[model samples]
Target chain A: MTQVIVTVMPKQGVLDPQGQAVAGALGQLGFDGVGEVRIGKRIELSIAGDDPAGQARAMCEQLLANALIEDYTVEVGA
Target chain B: MSTTVAVLRFPGTLDHDSAVRAVEGLGATAVEAWHADAALPAGTDAVLLPGGFSYGDHLRCGAIASRAPIMGAVRRHAEAGGRVVGICNGFQVLCEAGLLPGALRRNSTLSFVCRQMELEVADDETPWTPGLETGAVISIPIKNNEGAWYGDAGTARVVLRYRDNLLGSTDAVAGVANAAGNVMGLMPHPEEACDALLGSTDGQIVLAGLIA
Candidate 1:
């Protein structure tokens, strides 16, 4: 069994309000040098297959991430 | 023959009833189509994807519902130049389904906005806005958590513009149509505003376009 992990993030230049709010909170807490914060989601799937990474990529392309506003990376292991 | 409009009902759709009511009020027959169904009702002249948190808004606002079984038929319908209108969450689904241009993202303010807003009819040539005049202002209510629209529409027509840039949409776009002009998606609840009792009858001016 291979574990595929997909990380999806708001594409650069897209407005990520939730990430900005978190960065604002960090700034208020005196965490200096926080340049930019963009939030995203991670999806993990357990697959029993020879090409789990390829399957995960196909899933990302089809439904897991929207190409219009988001970019995703898939990694396989374990 | 009276036009028949198919109002798609996804599992979590909240505004299907209002859409049906608005369609019936426009003197059109309203048929309810299910998300899991593989086809729309026969003789459907138009398709309406009403607002709601479909699939519990999982993955993204409309990500899951966009691939619902009935969407294949909707896509075919749009390809044949059938009129399709998506309101609020429906707009998100349209964008996700690639039937419309641009993507609706989380509101820039990161808040669920629910308010009556004025929209300027930027273009009145699409099937969804034939009853409106270019530059006319209409009152519609917008309610959603992820209603901010992103991306350049390129050749698609910008049919509606927010009068006050309420949700940080690019160029204050409230509604838009595909390049072919048969499909439209907007971030307002026109169905909810279809009656004078609901504080506005202006929505009828929009929905009435579906009947023909």
Candidate 2:
């Protein structure tokens, strides 16, 4: 079985209200030097395939992420 | 002939009844369609994606629901020129489904806004707003946490605009129509305002726009 991790984050130009709210809370807690924060989702998948990267890409494009507003990266586990 | 509007019910959908009643009240037939079903009800003239947290809003609001098997039918339907309207959460689904442009980011206020809002008619020729004159302002209920409409709206026409930019949407767009004018997605709940009990029948004008 091949394990892969997919990370989906909003595109640079998209507004991320939730991330902004979290960043605000971090500032209130006195976290210094935090410049920008963007929110995103991560999905881990285990599949039986020789090309886990291909499967991961399909998942992200078809269901795991909205390409219109999000960018995704996939990592394969050894 | 009476038109039949398919009211889709996803697992987390909570407002299908209002959509049904709104269509029936206008003398059209309302058929219940399921998200798991790969096909729409036979002879469905239009489809209404109602409000609710589909799939418990996992990943993102409307993200999962947009991939439902039934959306295939919806895409085919829209491609063939069938009318479709997504309201509130439904609007999010349409955007996620790629039937419309943009994403509905969390509201700038970070609160679930639930109240009556005034929408100015930006386009008067779409499937869901033809009954109203351009620049006509109508009252309807706006409710949702991720209600801020984002995206360029592409070549699709803007059908409605919030009078005050309540959710900080780009261009203050409250609703948009496909370039073909058959599919629409809006943040406001026009179905919820179709009766006097909801404090306005002005919404009937919007729904009737589909059938008329």
Candidate 3:
């Protein structure tokens, strides 16, 4: 079984209210030197395949992430 | 022959009945369609996807519902020039389905907004807004947590604009039509504003374009 991790982040220039809220809260909590903070999601998948990373990319294109508003990265683990 | 409008009902849809009634009140025959069904009813002239938390909004609002089997028919119908309108959550589904341009993001306020808002008829060329004159302003209720429309409308026609930009949508866009002008996705609840008792008959003006 191959394990894959997919990380999806809001595309640059897109408004991310949730991420902004988190950044604001961090500032309130006394965190310093934090530049623009953006938030995203991660998904882990276990599949029985030799090309799990390719499969994960296909999944991101089809359903895991919206290309218009998000960018995704895939990582494979043995 | 009276126009036949199909109102689609996905699990968790909250406004299918209201959409159906509004369509019927506008002199169109409204039929209920199911999400799992692969085809719309025979002789359907237009389609309406109503609002709600379909599939409990899992994996993102409208992401799962946009892939429902019935969407195949909806896409074919729209491609063939049939009128299609997606309201509120329905709008999100249309965006996700790639039938419409752009995506809806969380409102800038990070809170759900529910109230009547004013919209200007930005373009009267689409099949969904012919009843109103371009530049005309109408009041409709908008209720959603993720109602801020983003991305460039591109070649799509901007059909409506928010008078106040309450949701921080790009260009204050309230509604938009596909390049072909047959498919539309709007954030407001036009179905809920179809009667005076509902505080506005302005919605009827927008919906009447489906049959007119």
Candidate 4:
């Protein structure tokens, strides 16, 4: 069995209002040194596989992330 | 032959009734096609992807719904030069499905914009805007959380422009037609604007262009 972790985030130069709102809230709560916070999602999958990396990459491209405004990274581990 | 437009229904799709009503009001037959179904109704002259939070907007708005089985039929339909129109969330799905260019992202204001807006007809020759004169402004309701239109400037022919530049869309684009001019996706609810009771019939001109 292997674990695949996928991370998805909006591509640079695309507006991310949710991330901005969270950054604003963080500032309101007295957090410091947060410059341009960008938010994204992480998905973890457990699979019994011959090639989990390939499967994970296909998932990200076909379903997990939208290539138009988002970029995704997939990491497979034992 | 009379036109029949298929209105695709995904789980959580909220505006099917109004979309069907608008199409029917235009004297065409409107049929509801389920998301899981692999085919649209026979004789589907056009397809209308109505607005709503499909799959509860999971993954991303329109991401999950874009993979539905009926989309295969949509792709083939468009390939055969059939007309397709997507409104609001439907616009998001079309982008995700790759039937149209660009992706709709969160509004710059970080708030759901729900109001009547004026859109200039940037391209009057599209399948959904023949009656509209170039540069003519039409009023309609636009409501969405992730309605910002983004795309490559050279690839997208701006079909409409907002009077006040709502949502910070690139080039004030309110809508766009595919390079073939057969498919269009826009951020406004032209269906909800099809009646005098809605305080405007400007959307009729757009919808009427579909069947004409």
For model 2 chain B, the run of ten residues with the poorest summed lDDT: B148-157
Q: What is the C-alpha lDDT of each candidate?
A: 0.90, 0.88, 0.91, 0.89
lDDT of 1: 0.90
TM-score of 3: 0.97
Comparing only chain A of model 1 with the true chain A, what is the TM-score? Answer: 0.95
Q: Tens digits of per-residue lDDT for model 4 on B1-212?
A: 67999999999999999999999998999999999999999888999999999999998889999999999999999999998999998999998999888888888888999999999998877867776689898999999988888888577867888998879888878898888888888999999898898989989888875795
lDDT of 3 by residue, A8-49 (tens): 999998888898999899999999777798989999999777
Count clashes in each candidate, considering only residues at least 3 apart in sequence or on different chains: 0, 0, 0, 0
Which candidate leads in DockQ?
Answer: 1
Q: What DockQ does each prediction reach against the true complex?
A: 0.93, 0.76, 0.90, 0.84
Query: Which ranges in model 4 have alpha carbons more than 4 Å from their true place?
Result: none
lDDT of 1 at B26: 87
- Residue A55 CA displacement from its true place in model 2, Å: 1.2
Candidate 1: where are CA atoms >4 Å away?
none
For the second chain, the TM-scores of the candidates in order are 0.97, 0.97, 0.97, 0.97
User: What share of the reference contacts survives in each candidate?
Assistant: 1.00, 0.86, 0.93, 0.93
Tens-digit lDDT string for candidate 2 (B45-76): 98999999999988889999998999999999
lDDT minimum window of 10 residues, candidate 3 chain B = B124-133
Which residue segments of model 2 deviate by more than 4 Å?
none
The deviation in Å at residue B175 for candidate 1 is 0.7
* Total residue pair clashes for candidate 1: 0
